[model samples]
Target: MSDKKIITVFCATGAQGGAVARALSKDPDLHVRAVTRDVNTQKADKLKSLGVELVQCNTSNPASVRDALSGADGCFIVTHTDFGKQNSFEMEVHEGRQIADACKAMRVGSVVFSTQRSSRVLGLQTRHMDAKAEIETYMHDLDLPLTCVMVPCYYEQFMGLFKPEKIDNNKYILEIPMGTTPMHLIALDDMGVVVRQIFNNWQTFIDKTIGICGDVLTIRDVAAILTQVLRPKTFADKPLTVNDYRNKKDFPGVSDWANLFTFRMRVDQIFNIHHTKMIHPQMKSFEEWARENADTLHNVL
Candidate 1:
């Protein structure tokens, strides 16, 4: 029985939350309060078996989030905005706000928000990222102990995007159309490792916005890595033009997403020299991710 502080984590059933909660669960220095909308889900049951205190909560509801955070010292706040939500942007922003308010009112040691990497400036076309930008600002204004983790596109998302490449050569290509601008990709597994450290050392990080990325790769660089593992393949650089990204986007978020990826409306240096110096400087490369994700390579392709 190692004595550690209890930390409540929101969205514990989903990607960011699950990673954060799972990481915290393994640490002897921290206790995890895993929250979920469905307490009976396998994920929740699994967390319970691992000694996580399960809290049923929804971010959209302040009362639920507050109840989840009521007895905890800290929390990890993240939201899932489905593609087809009637009010996707509002839903995410409101959820974040509710989490922040609960953290402040409850006097939690800190609130770590899950945000996206975008411009240091503002007016990103993507509703989700822009919503994060807004929520981050509000979190700061409240003057509570906080750390905002800014995530880039997940390395996992690439697998979901170009399935054809996965099917043909058993190799998936990384195809973000910045022409080798080094799109930083993050592995979902690695995210938990980094955030676990933050929760363990809460005092050193306050009022900080850190860019979190496990790997960096361009369209071609990733393809090369895939070729090595899968063999004799070229990852296509299939980036849509500004017009196409805005007009021909697969979903309703085309214009919003195009605003950042296509037009570069908000490219920022949150991961600049100084920012990296503050946090752990270790960043994963595409090759490292490919090797670690080898288990999925055969099946994904």
Candidate 2:
């Protein structure tokens, strides 16, 4: 029998949880209990092959969560508010509380909850961010060891939302809001590395709320880098006005995102790049992420 501390990772097949599950599964000091609603999927199969124990658990079901947390020494909890029909803020908060309640009951030693920076800081109410803020409060009131990680915009957003399009010949356009204001971004994979660091240094992170960002750059800066990577292809940064973003029909959650971006611009001083870099030195810059995913970036457009 292997003697390793069990770490229950919820959403084991999705982005956040999958990253943690993959990272922890490689560690000799911990065992990963990968929880997913379905176990027959390809991602779950791949994780199982890596010696990760698969546990079927739905965040909506408290009993399932309790079963997954049983005998686990630690947990990495994350609730999704973007999935189809799961976008309800109430639903997200309910699921989060269920997970936290289970964690408290299990007496888990270490927990790193994936949350977003407070919406209250900007004096606005964003459903997704507000849900996380509520969950953070619930977790804080619990007696269990916990740490909250607030992530900024994802670096991968460029692959879809800001994908460069060929306008004419080699000229391309990457459109987004925030004309020159720096936007913070983080690699989805880097979240796993940071969570691992938190678990390894549990005492240092207790009750502390930390925000992680891979890079801070304006859309123009990002366009410049994309031009260099996809050479012979010059790109232009097209600024989308807040009014336009709020009314953009093609995008769902336009109002929420509009509020978020507006608030981000208002409180630009809070997402300190220097301090975030100090915590996760391995964080990648936009250029680094661009170069690594060059082929994929090119294919998107």
Candidate 3:
């Protein structure tokens, strides 16, 4: 029997969990058990190729969660909001609670959970964020040895959901709801690095909630960086308010996102970029991320 510590990573095929699995798999002192809904996918195959154990798991099922976390010394968990799904908040909370309950029952030594601030408690109704916050509270109530990591908006959103809209004349407009407030941002890959450090030094993070970010910049700063990287296709930041964003009903979760932005604007110190840099010295800034993803950005245009 190997004496190495076992770490189970839930949602190992997705962005956040996949990064954690890849990072932990590199440590000889730790064994990574990657849990996914399906083990036959290309992403799962890649993890298998790295000598990580893959287990099929449905997070919403209590028995499945327990089976996956049966012998884990530590675990990393992230629950998605599944926005636009009916009762999305309730569904997320259920899934998260199931996982947390399993961790408690299985007596997992350390748990690193990805959670967010409670917009509900702050007088707003960002269901997604509140759902995660509710899960965090549940874990705390269980008296589980837990470390909560709160991530800000992802830099990867630029490639998908938050991609700027192109008007005429090769110009693009970025329409984030923050007028002049600096928004915290992180690369998904960098989250892996930070979580790895947290797991490596679990005792230090026990019962602590950490908010991490790679950069904090206004929408205009983001646009400027994009313009610098993709010069021929100029980018500009639109001065859109939270109310304006809330009025955009064409997209799913508009009100939730609008409330989230409003909360962020009113709140201070949502993320600590300096502390995050201390944890992961090589975390990528927005400019660095934009420069590296310039080709993909161009392709999307």
* lDDT of candidates 1 onward, in order: 0.71, 0.82, 0.90
Ranking by TM-score: 3, 2, 1
Model 2 lDDT tens row, 169-276: 889886677878888888877778888888888898988878787888888988889899988878888788877866763555666677777878877545556766
Model 1 gets an lDDT of 0.71
Off by over 4 Å in 2: 83-87, 120-123
lDDT of 2 at 20: 87
Maximum-lDDT candidate:
3
Q: Which scores higher on lDDT, 2 or 3?
A: 3
Model 1: what TM-score? Answer: 0.86
Against the correct fold, how does model 3 do in TM-score? Answer: 0.95
Q: Each model's TM-score? A: 0.86, 0.92, 0.95
Which 10 successive residues of model 1 have the least lDDT summed? Answer: 265-274
